[model samples]
Target: MFTRIRMVVLATNAEGSPDLFLTTVDATGTQYEHGRHYDMALPRARDEGYETPMIAFDQYDAAARMLRRAATFIEGGDAATGN
Candidate 1:
């Protein structure tokens, strides 16, 4: 429970039938980072020496989203410019 929460994944206890609450499953030790902070900082991140966030390999969707945010920052899109 100490680890950062990326997904609120849960499994119902139909087989064992735990009362009051469902069980938690830790399938992968490799956790995915949610980059909202990085997204918000995108406008000035590069200027301040903050590189674009990195998602894990084969995670094309997350990678694409990060790229799009960087692109927006570069293009002067909706992201607020200036420090």
Candidate 2:
């Protein structure tokens, strides 16, 4: 029993150099590094139901950025922090 998974990495380039590396794990337990993209197959359960095999790098980046911004707001003189 095996499953297919995809990993998408997003990073910023500085002076032709790569900066910041983030890794994400899909349902198949495959790890992907930032600025690098790859796919692999994972072990799956025989009794598992239908599963969609896909990964959206843009979406993940957007969500991560949003969360970071939110955290900054909360930590930086924001009412939510109750500071």
Compose the digit string of candidate 2's lDDT tens values, residues 1-83: 22333323333333334333333334322333433223321112111221233233423456555545666786785544534
Output the worst ten-in-a-row residue range by lDDT, candidate 1.
Answer: 3-12
> What are the lDDT figures for the candidates, one per model?
0.33, 0.37
- Kindly provide the TM-score of model 1 when superposed on the true structure, using C-alpha atoms: 0.23
Which residue pairs collide, candidate 1?
A: none
- What's the TM-score of every candidate structure? 0.23, 0.24
Off by over 4 Å in 2: 1-60, 77-83
TM-score computed on alpha carbons, candidate 2: 0.24
The C-alpha local distance difference test score for the whole of candidate 2 amounts to: 0.37
Candidate 2: give the clashing pairs.
Answer: none
| C-alpha RMSD values across all candidates | 18.1, 13.3
lDDT of 1 at 15: 46
In candidate 2, where is summed lDDT lowest over 10 consecutive residues?
Answer: 41-50
